[model samples]
Target: MGYDLERFVGYVNEGLLCCVCRDVLEDPLQAPCEHAFCSSCIHGWLVHHNTCPEDRLPLDITHLRPLFRYMRNDLARLQVRCVFRPQGCEVICALESVHRHEQQCDYALLNCSNAGCPVQVSRRSLEAHLCVCEYSSRVCSSGCGYTVLNTEEAQHNCVSELRAELDMLRAELDCKVEEVRHEMESRLDSQRRHMVQKESLLRSEVDELKGQLSRVMSDVRILLGAERARRQELERAELEKAELLELLKKEGLRPATPSEAAPPPAEVQRKLSPRSLALDCIKRKNREVTVI
Candidate 1:
């Protein structure tokens, strides 16, 4: 169905030819009366009439039968040239395989898929044409909105690649600077918090030391007051002792009896031994003044 029937013009067997198309039969179908016609031709005829084209016999699509095995084997051997022969294809193929060969032929003409392209290329050249087609669009690598065909891409100079790169680097530098600034600020805040804590600790220690010093000073004052009272008591005792000794020396002495000359009682001896003896010597030295 894909090959041109004219390409098989003189090489077809008359027995295998379709009555309607006058060419080699392809997918031949036999009517109820055994008349053979190409399936496509008979199908098109049955669209208007329910009768076979050869015998005018009553027929429906359901009554149509496939051609015998001999007809198919004969059709398979029929030689046909590629439909793209005018397009530079020189290969000859069997009628049965002509469709397959034409489908893959390099000389096959293909219309460009691009809607704005009007070029017809060979099947092999189609791929290369699509690559450089003017109607095709592509994005600019610089992020500039200059999408156009490769043929006209050089007309618009929306942005320079070097300038775009410089802008990108500048933006990155600004971002890095901002990041560094934020990091520095964060470190400063952390250091300030640490300093505040250290100051608070130092103040607490200072208050503790002050409290300790105040307690020590109070203790020292109490000790000094006790020491002063003790010193005053000792001075008063010395003064009273001196006055008692003076009185003793001033009293008139009794004549020494035998018993008085004897040792005094133990209790009196203990009180008057060393200090009283010294006082007696002082009194004797003064007796002369009083006796005179």
Candidate 2:
């Protein structure tokens, strides 16, 4: 121990590796007894033992302080490996570029954060697997293949399959509804045709009945007119026959033959009286009714 500032300045560039993590000294700190340690290394050591390995002094994590900004910048300029390279990552970078490189490294090895799918996988392959992975799923509009979120690769909810099933069911229901509508339309058309046919038949029947009713009314009027005329004729014949019979009585002559007994009228030999004419018309109407 002799003071050597120039030598120490040259040696600062040379780094010490951590015994546990094997990374370069991240934030070099000192124990109370003057031994130096990487902050991370010391933190791990303190987790199990509160004393420093070299000095055996009591240690506390609260005593850790922020590294100098300039020192951090200098350390960042040093060479480092791709943090997850051993699993499949091929990229190596300076410590400064490690953050950005790790984010984009396709070959980086990744452990599935899902409690269910705990397989170790490459970052690029992890996304591909999640597309068909069973444990982690995401909502998909087109198909059941679950899409993985780049930002939240391991936190997708497994609902894509269910959503796909629901969509299928809705499609099936729609088909059924369309089928029912078609059937109803067919039935309605059939019923409408039947009603139209029935109405046509009823209209034809009504037409026939109207024609018969018209003929019957006309015949009834003609028969009634003829009966009236015939009755008047019969009345005149009865009056003539009465006058002839009175003449015979005045002359004191007895009518011996049937022709002399009742003088023949122009219409009939048995000329009717007024009351008899009306009775004969009634009897003819009754006989016609019986014939009908």
Candidate 3:
């Protein structure tokens, strides 16, 4: 609601009065119809009826605007008494300054600072009342780390309070420890799973390597067998060569005994020369060796 009309030092223009409350407009707003009302009054009225309170004309919150500059200046210049005048404050000020004055007014009533204190005291006496309020609180002199109310001072037990605080701390510590333990367990389980995967991967790699090794060993064994067969064949060829030499000796075809050998008849010599016969035998042996 707007300020009480009686609080003004002189007559207030009717135009400055709220259409809803009929009081001097406080934080006034004007409708498109040129009628003004206290902002709160207009908003509250609009909640029930969407029409200008003065003309009953169609209106809405969207149609409201700030009061005209001249009207606002006139409203601000009006002399008003302190809101706490009934409480012994005798200050008077412009309408615009009334709120500031009342805020600092020594006679303004305030709720007690203490919790659960129902008493309201004037600003001038608030400090004095707070000093004696039974609900007022202060830290325990016994260093129990707790605020004790004046009313409960006689029953306050410092030892019990401290014990309860210790118990609370212990419970919090236990909770933190349990949390850390669970986190560690979770980490360990994750590591174990990772290790298991790594081990499986490693085993798979090892098996792969073993299979490759087996293949290599099989190839090596085959090569070794082939080499052995080649060596034995070479040995057999050498033995056959020695036997051929012995047979040539037995047939009296040795060139070293040419002086002791008998000469063939001219007819036999013409049919098969000795040099030609030797060359034929060599050619036959070369063919057999090439086949082997």
Which has the greatest lDDT? 3
Worst 10 residues of 3 by lDDT: 254-263
Global lDDT of each candidate: 0.76, 0.62, 0.85
lDDT of 1 by residue, 222-250 (tens): 99999999999787668657865655554
Q: Pick the candidate with the highest TM-score.
A: 3
Error of 3 at 134 (Å): 1.3
1 against 3, candidate with superior TM-score: 3
Q: How many residue pairs clash in each candidate?
A: 0, 0, 0
lDDT of 2 by residue, 113-232 (tens): 665676777877987777655566444544546665444555545575567778999999999999999999999999999999999999999999999999999999999999999998
Question: Per-residue CA lDDT of candidate 3, range 49-101, in tens?
Answer: 99998899999999999999999999999999998988999898998988888
Quote each prediction's TM-score: 0.49, 0.33, 0.64
Q: After superposition, how far is residue 116 of candidate 3 from its true place, in Å?
A: 5.0
Query: Runs in model 2 with CA error above 4 Å?
Result: 1-15, 18-23, 32-34, 44-51, 55-73, 110-120, 131-292
- The 10 consecutive residues of candidate 1 with the worst lDDT sum are 255-264
